[model samples]
Target chain A: MPAEPARRPTLDRVLRIDQATYDAIVEHARRDHPVEACGMVAGPLGSDRPVRLIEMVNAAGSPTFYEYDSTDLLRLYRELDDRDEEPVVIYHSHTATEAYPSVTDINLASEPGAHYVLVSTQEHGNNAGPVEFRSYRIIDGVVTEEEVTIAAAVDTNDAAEEHS
Target chain B: MAIEVRIPTILRTYTGGEKAVNADSAGAGTLSALIDSLEANHPGIKDRLIDGEDLRRFVNIYINDEDVRFIGSLEAALSDGDQVVILPAVAGGAR
Candidate 1:
């Protein structure tokens, strides 16, 4: 008998995001090229679907760094709490690199429950061209790349209906 | 003198998965005192929230609607019924 392959079963580690939201993220990244753009997509707690996209200002305003304005961060959490939602997706962009998490990104990833999305505009800055969009799970200093599915319609769990 | 401290998702483990916990004996005086009181109950959490004497640069703490950094940092005043929210900064970089 052949030795069993030392591999874990391929579970469905995918990010099912909507087309409009996806476009918005790309657009935001393009607009903030050279200066990183960051945002969040909030959804009902436990719902893996990213339904709402909220663009945030990069307080650092640096070409290679991004940080949500401190005041805005607080308000965003309050809004999420009011709607019984969570940051299902936390996204940012890279101006001159590929769509991948940098060392700083991995170290600063605090939301283990969120899908970390990275959009790279290095190919075409603020213009129409192929952009690299990717997603990952960064938890406890570990990075696991995941597949991103652009769904025309997202079907969140039952909890999503309560708010809608 | 109870101060309700809201724990972010990352720090929930120290809080036993609690979203919010009341620091009853936190001496309704200053933010630093409240943290000490919390440390007494939840071991190893203070280290995550505070680096040496100052708050970790990436960790954000808001007392009511005001950020602790603007108020007075560790010495920020606290009172009953003030909602203390602790949120790690949503930040990263390309380099």
Candidate 2:
């Protein structure tokens, strides 16, 4: 029998958010604007539900800048590994801004893979819907929009409850 | 209409009330020219996004977030539906 060829790896989608997640992220950004909001998007093994924000990290604003804490990022990555789920997408909110990357955001686009999603929010408002949820792939500082596969409700709440 | 170009928040005040603006052009398309046209219309956006040296080391432009620097700098091709997003070096965490 002939040996089979290895499958090519596909890039994970950043996911399109539903009303629930839209609410969760917007609320998170509103509660902590002027600063930045951070979180991880995860899914079950080989899931097609797209990437979902299973958890969030707040209090990112230090001296008027919302920075994704490296420690929090490490913790999230570790949790995803433990769950046997893949970390497909990484998202952040641009409070008082647009879906475009900022001067600071550009400098930090160092992660090799993983779709980067930006939720540009209203200058000020809690219930304000996101101005836009756009996706990007930044490799060596060049960015291009990739097709994001959005899953409806990939809930890890059950797992969270069980683990908690 | 030629093509509508949208400026990000940080670059908006430069455009003056015009978040999305139209660009008049020739077939000559280069990152440098596109920016010159934008600067002509918006006045100060190019300066903020670029410095005299190169695109500000901090600013990243996505011909949809793919990073123009790695692709072709300012020479990246432009399509009708293409959306360009610019973000600063927003790096941080909880403290």
Candidate 3:
């Protein structure tokens, strides 16, 4: 038999967060000086998972940190399950570095259902606005970054266009 | 009862910059209580370990390096020398 065909993602809608939510996340990330910051986005349950909120989670991070905790992921899952919602995507911020996945990051994403969204807050020793939003997916231990297109919170288009 | 708690890198800030914090004995002997004692002394570190009553989304507390989800969560017990390490959910590009 030929190799298994690729499964195209059917992402019909993308949800954006208001300025308030954005500020909340940035503040949270800044509070944790050196280690990485993590959180999630969610909205009304539907065919298109709406990720509209960013909840800053806590971690046991050290200066030489490698991995992030998954306790909050489980709690998010349970909360959504109880509220009759679903996980649209998973998000985290890189405070001291670009919003890209490190080597350890790829090795840890065993789940394919969630999309990893990274925010490049790298200051490069200078202060500037957050650069961009990047995304990724890990399959069979291989990681592939995806491009995400951000739009107005009320825009018909989603924050992401396609998956690679 | 004296218990040994394994601390993950992410939350080391709260334990006075120590890699691992040992308690002669934890208060309630539960994960929540363990964190509570840590936060009470750390002053504002609780927000980093938990979000409200729920543990932070990206972190995990393993009893002896095994996933607590597959076992038991906050209710997971502690012995005289049990080890609890906190971990976070991380993902990314090719190495």
Candidate 4:
């Protein structure tokens, strides 16, 4: 009998965000109506937790595309490096589309470890009834949708009590 | 020591599946020169990154997290311990 081929390694495919972080991302998306908004959340190196929310300007300023200002990106990276932090979450908003990674997004994802978050504000403008918010992992030119867990402290405590 | 160039997943085929490779830029310090050196070490890799003396429209090159396009494109300078990253342009979040 022939031996079975080795299985490919699986990529990390889950993202956890707190309520405040989630709300901030949505608000930034809504504020930049029509044009796309992009930003990053930094965390201590090797810690997957995203603690800092950074709002970035859409250099492209286009509805269909987004690009971080090269200068700003460089400065931000340098600062992160100095502080022993890394971009744990890189996010963007799609005004007229669902929250999903586009072909270009998968192509440009350089930080394989960071959670790529996408928010859609197509239905409502600031006054939200329904908005699409999702997270993904893009590694090796492949995109994998991941489960997003809202980590509210009160909710966690309540869930813990129920479990106990 | 040579500068390290990170090869994207789509371009790894040309590098024999190597994720990163080192290229000496002692004689030439510009990004263009480093790319030429990379091509010399790994044939057919330059074609994916360059077209008619210009980088492909969809390709993005970054050195130490700073985009080369904003600095000087192909003329961006290099130094020891510098890291280079190449990626394709992603667009269209629209429905």
Provide interface RMSD per model, one decimal: 0.6, 10.7, 8.0, 4.3
**What's the DockQ of model 3?**
0.17
Q: Considering every candidate listed, which one attains the maximal TM-score?
A: 1
The candidate, 2 or 3, that scores higher on lDDT is 2
Candidate 1 or 2, higher TM-score? 1
Model 4, range A51-135, lDDT digits (tens) per residue? Answer: 7889988888988899876566656766775776777899999888777777778766767778889998888956666778888
Better of 1 and 2 by lDDT: 1
Error of 3 at B86 (Å): 16
Top candidate, metric DockQ: 1
The C-alpha stretches of model 2 lying farther than 4 A from their native spots are A1-18, A45-54, A58-64, A147-164, B1-95
Between 2 and 4, whose DockQ is larger? 4
DockQ of each: 0.90, 0.08, 0.17, 0.24
TM-score of each: 0.93, 0.47, 0.48, 0.71
Local accuracy of candidate 2 as per-residue lDDT tens digits, A1-164: 11222111135534454556656666766665655677656665455233467546554444224544334444454465577665455667776656655555554665545566666664454455435666676555656665544455555455442431
- Each candidate's chain A: what TM-score? 0.90, 0.65, 0.63, 0.84
lDDT of 1 by residue, A77-160 (tens): 999999888999999999998888888999999999899999999999999998999998888987777778898878754656
Candidate 1 segments whose C-alpha is farther than 4 A from its true place: A1-11, A156-159, B24-28
> Any residue pairs clashing in model 1, and if so which?
none
Q: Over the stretch B1-95, how does candidate 4's per-residue lDDT look in tens digits?
A: 48998776568878898978999775778999999899998999899899998988767789988789878999898988999977654333553
